[model samples]
Target: MNQFIPCGLVPRLAVTVVLVLVAARCGGGGPTTPPPPIPTLTIACPTAEPVQSTDNNPRVVTFGTAVATGGVGPLTTTCSAASGAEFPVGTTTVTCTAVDARGVSALCTFPVVVRPPPRLTGTRFLAFGDSITWGVDSPPIPAAAPSFAYPEQLQQRLAARYRLQTPQVINVGEPGEQAQDGGIRRFRSVLLQHRPDIVILMEGTNDLLSLEVGIERGIEALRDMIREAKGQNVRVLLSTIIPQRMNGFRVPNRNPFAVLVPPFNDRVRALAASENVPLVDMFQVFAADMSLLGIDDVHPTVRGFQVMADTFFEAIRANFEQQVAAGVGGLP
Candidate 1:
């Protein structure tokens, strides 16, 4: 049966089968290639808008939302300024940026306007002391030229120098009241009534009159007063009792009843040092200027009151300096 088939035809058939097998092994198509990947977009907040507050109170603001185009994980936002890195009042701008899983990033801008906070007009002061502080002995005068009590003089000085507009000084001194008596009464009348920013204490003079009252008790009373003020975030200024040459010149001794002065001053100094309260050394000031004293020996003359007022002014100015250094500007 094969005698009719040609030999060349058999070879040709074999060659064709080989070529088809080779083509199949080679995948029978054009060159292999992969499809392009999808693009991802994202945003990052590099800076935040400035928040302005007119008042001294703190203010807080929020940043806008961040977005990412690709399937990325766990994004975070942050804020910063260009120069000082602190946010101040008025118009401020921040740069916003975005990143994707592919390490590609985008950038934009955020604009913010901050308004001022409400202003605090004035601060209150509370003066606690004895006869001199109460201005009890001063003669009556017209309202315009009211007898210049030390507290009144302090108020005037603060208004003029520190720019404390309409500052209020509440004198809570009671004549012949000792530290113990004043401490017991202050919580209700002076402390809670006005909630003063600062409390100036001119006490212990009457306490010294009693030879029986130990120095420790006076110290304790002073500490109590400080604790009370600290509870309400009020500052304190302690003044040393002025030296007395004689007890109203009525006593038999020509020598000073000044025995009480040294001990009382010592206790006050110790209390002030321990409690970290500001102190005005009226003793030193008055000792240098005896002319300020009146004939009564206990009370200070008009000139003496003026000197006391000057000492208080120095103390207040020192406080202002401390506040300014601590970054607290303006009145309390």
Candidate 2:
């Protein structure tokens, strides 16, 4: 409102107004500016209990909710899988990502393990292959019976370790049969007949040496056999064909196909990885000791069979024969 004012009073009022404005500008009057936000964005994933697989290999797994913390406003979070997701009988990883409006991102991962019900359920074992499985020790085509072969030895070893259960290894190794015509064709029938828990597959030596059957064909045939076994829920332990010295077939003629062993074994390794199966590198073992081979250069000596037994023993024990412990169950 307009009022009576002296010149001295007007100057003092202007000076007071100026001092207030100066105080406001010098951080002594109004609210102060806030510091920039510190970046502490974190994506936290919940610890989930492992789901046990049932009749199906893959089970439906439900996990706790994942969240993001300590980020700026308008933060967005995304997870790889929702709560109810189908997980296979192994480890499955779930990742969560949190992104702020400023494009700052934080990531975290947690594993969802789905365990199967005792991979080794039964004690029946099937040793399936060609002449090597038939056990043609020295020469004369076959040694009548595979009594002293790797299969028998493996059976003995398993029985020795597992005193409670009688581990029976049935030698179904047919001589001179190609993988396609012999292995893949009759694999399902054999599986049905034997009802084995594990199959020791060591075929394709005939295909390697045969002119009609190519080694690649043998590899495919082996793949088919592996799938057939898996379809029956039977575990498989694949083995590479043993090294063969030149001049096989008792003709003393140089075996031109002997050169194919290395490539064939390499393919076997890749096949093992692709199929996600356990592989026993018998080629590496036999190649190391040429003395272990028989006079015919194709079959293994008694010593070589013993070594094969030892190798297979370790594989079986490591994978299947674990004594039952807390969180680590094994066969009875």
Candidate 3:
């Protein structure tokens, strides 16, 4: 058979066979490379320093200060004490964690001990405000029946949640009394007299309604209140006014006055921020369900007052807990 074929044809045929075999082999792709493994993270707290306290309690020990891991990226840290571990009377433990950008995490614990809350024999809280602050539109209307205003509700919630002794809450809200009036004559005589641990200032509604005072004046009044309170070492919590959708407007003439609400709230928010005071945004809470207000649309109903009280309770509880943990001697 080879003798009959051309000499070039044999070599060509051999080359063709080799090319076919190569094509067949290349038809299926080669195996793929595997992905890299995810990095692991671990955390620990090392006992290093002991905190001292005047109270007769065990000193607290802190855990690891630095987090070490194999991976690299931005890391976030969080700390918490172990469960069921009683913070020794004089000391407490704090745990911290570091998390990398890849979601890897590491943890550490530290101990810090200090004097506990002073055996506060008693504590007083004062609330100052306008009509709403006085529970003007509260329900079960005998018009004369005592309305459990937000302040009273706040007291109850604090007692239940924090196990704090029932504090004497004095409500000094005078209906129709503008902040100007309060700043000039009322605040000192009534509020400063009690030596309150905390003071809640809810004024400015009357100021906005009566004098149409601008935001600057409101801020000044708030500053004055804060200055007075700080002089006595009393902590202050400022609250924004709830929005009013009154039927009659007072600005350009007696028409719908809803437009005024936003401007007033803006001023109050700015004042709160500049003063570095805790602000309870009551308008948003009440505005969540518009039906909570009374028929007149200015005052919140009983349910509305409950919601307001709850809001106040949340802010107050957080502040109190922090102050307690810090062993700071001042109103939270």
Candidate 4:
């Protein structure tokens, strides 16, 4: 009673079904699609502190050695602070970032500390005087040299006492110069130029040599110099002249200049007192000891200079300590 089905039609139908399944699996009808990839990035921690110079002012810092890792291939690297460029003093943040072509990025940060220079690093002192102040008989030696003139020795001693910065003592001493030349022609300009914290005024020996010019001229010149220095707001430390001997021996009697020296020193004391300035009394210590004198009657030997340094150091210590205690001046 049932009708018979066609065998060829059944086979064609089976083949058509297989083709449809293959098309769907291959995406033959539309664009092909793939699974999305996960993005990745990483940054290494810096191992050391950034390097920089210690100076009074801000300076450049460098950090080209910082490392970064996996992002997309062929990564580009950059930093927030450029290498070898000026940076401010104190802690500066440095960030180094690496970016791949795909825009995936990684970053690392570290701190750089730029310490400011030591306080009061330049302690300026103008050693204003004649040949003696210039480190005469023996030329002035550097602060680090073995043998120092009084001024250089004074700087060393002061540094030791404070246990802090080394002072710069500029010797502007002219050999054979009287107070007239120093105070009138040289004092004001030097004071203005150097602008030192202290001026050690020691002159008058040459002026004493001239009986006609007299000691008064030297005294007056010193007074003028002191006034000029004070006008500039610079402190003055007045030093009395040291004893004189002839050729490493006592001078014969009738040394007219000897009489004048004591009086000249007396005048120096009177001037310092009148002006209310500090005094380094070299004369008091030297008056009894001819041994301190150099081959020349006027100049000091090495020992003499050391003695001078000792006297000056005492005055400097007192002044420096007083000022520091009162919160006036010392290490900034």
Candidate 5:
């Protein structure tokens, strides 16, 4: 049978069908959703070896220039070792990871090789001096061992520089000992006992205070010591006595002993030149900076002792490196 429908009813049926389709589209669980794409993350470690200073201690390595590429969202590259971190001697594997805001990360590692400082030839050293050498009336110098004097400090410096060889630096410093007695009689005993390759001689500071041991006698004693060392075939390195600092408690820091420094140092200079001995001018070091001397006006402060070690090290190294390199007077 043919069914007859009105035009208004047909339009209403069409509108109802359209609404049902729209409801289906708005409903949950309509279609499977695709997973989010993986974020890009990659990092590059330092390729070239970074030039480091020639010091034996752990070095602070900087990698501010190491960059990461192809990362999504906010990206950051972090290292296991932070920048300015001290890396110890030898190879250290440093890992750098790049991460994005999406929690995606990629890492790269590099090897940093830190070699020990270069070595020197001579291993035996004898440091001969007076109370200043004994570290008298000064701030306690920092040291690993009980001895905080320059000879001990010098040993530490050498050990740090030359890890392969063992060095022995004997400190034979006598407190209140004058140059005439120590430099002549005791020096020969020490030289015979130690049989060192180098003798670091810094005396005559105490001699200036003695009325009997004037500059003339002091100079002769030093000359005798040099002659004694040469007779034994051991090298003698000389140093001028550092000037006594003025009393800071008193306005001028005026040391009554200060007036005598120049003439005495001049004589030492002349002696070194005449003897052709290697000289470390400690006088200039103190005169340039009086703070190196402590309040007692005779002994050096802790930092002064460090500078003392440094100067001695430089003098020894400069003088001996060539000879040792040529296999003249070298360590075993």
Candidate 6:
């Protein structure tokens, strides 16, 4: 079928159609252009509370999943301190970064605190004994010679291993202090003064030197000191007496008091075993190495002190590990 049209109407219709086509070709009469998509990034894992470090143990950081959407394909995600990596003690920033294929990145940071174990923070260790604990040997003098003593060195070692605040190691050793004096008179006062979390008892050397005091008396005094410290809720670490040098069936002239070492150390071992107190076997450490002793063969050299510190550190670390494993808090 054909429809008739006036010449004037056909010409107007054709002109209108041409105008519409021209407008469409010039892109002025089509749907509006779509806006660019918003880049999407979100942290799937919520912020987690700081976790405390276990005693003498390491802890690793764990992270949750992160998601990204609405960006270019092939998104990438990275995290600082990747999962299962050990974190140092204290607060650590675990950053999860989400990167889109368009090179756009969003960051999510959470605190992963590794709190120190109670043993490492605000804990005091008192080295209580005779001249040995006083740090008599090597360069520098007593009390001030902690740098050459086992206690201070142990503090440093522990700080390194645990990555926490170093504990205070107070040297309360007197040059000629006796164990009986410590057990009866000085124990309560010193403990009250320092309020130490632990006490390293290494007396009895002076007691044995007296000869008249006898090894049994020294042992009894040590036992008394241990009991007193334990009663006061202070952990005790008993150290065996170090060995002295002998020259051809004769005690060294400088160390005339060496006669009492063998029996005294034996009693010390027995006491520690019977009482179940932690023991640092210093006697065995120095027994084979005479060079570790000073010129007098009684006191230790600087190197010797370092070794002693290592031994004590190991024992203490082991004790802490055992306690933690057993789920026990404080002293056993």
Better of 3 and 6 by lDDT: 6
Residue-wise C-alpha lDDT for candidate 6, range 1-332, written one tens digit per residue: 13444333344446666655555555558688799877675544346555566453556766556555556768788776666677666666667777777787777776666656645423578888877877788433334555677777877877666544556678887776777655446877998888988888887776766674667777888888788888888988899988877652334363456766877888899999999898888998998787888766678888888888888877777665322211212111
Off by over 4 Å in 1: 1-122, 137-146, 212-214, 246-248, 253-257, 321-332
The better-scoring model by TM-score among 1 and 5 is: 5
* TM-score for candidate 6: 0.59
Predictions in order: lDDT: 0.64, 0.79, 0.63, 0.70, 0.74, 0.71
Which pairs of residues have clashing backbones in candidate 4?
Answer: none
Q: Rank the candidates by lDDT, best first.
A: 2, 5, 6, 4, 1, 3
TM-score of 4: 0.56
Which pairs of residues have clashing backbones in candidate 1?
Answer: 42-98, 43-98, 44-97, 44-98, 53-117, 54-116, 54-117, 55-117
TM-score of each: 0.56, 0.60, 0.57, 0.56, 0.60, 0.59
Cα lDDT of model 6 overall?
A: 0.71
Tell me the deviation in Å of residue 185 in model 4: 1.0
Worst 10 residues of 5 by lDDT: 323-332
Worst 10 residues of 1 by lDDT: 323-332
Model 4 per-residue lDDT at 121: 22
**Compared with the true structure, what per-residue lDDT tens digits does model 1 show for residues 1-332?**
22333323344545666545555555665677887665555554434455545343434556655444543434333333342343434445666565544456666555544444422223578888888787653222212223577888877766655442456677777777888766556654578888888888878767765654745566678888888888888888888888776544544642434677777898888888999998888988878876666666666777777777788877776664333211212112
Provide backbone clash counts, one per model: 8, 0, 19, 0, 2, 0
Measured with C-alpha atoms, the lDDT of residue 196 in candidate 6 is 88
Instruction: Report how far residue 117 has shifted in candidate 2, in Å.
Output: 20
Cα lDDT of model 4 by residue, 1-28, tens digit: 1233343333354566555555554555
Error of 1 at 261 (Å): 0.7
lDDT-best of 1 and 4:
4
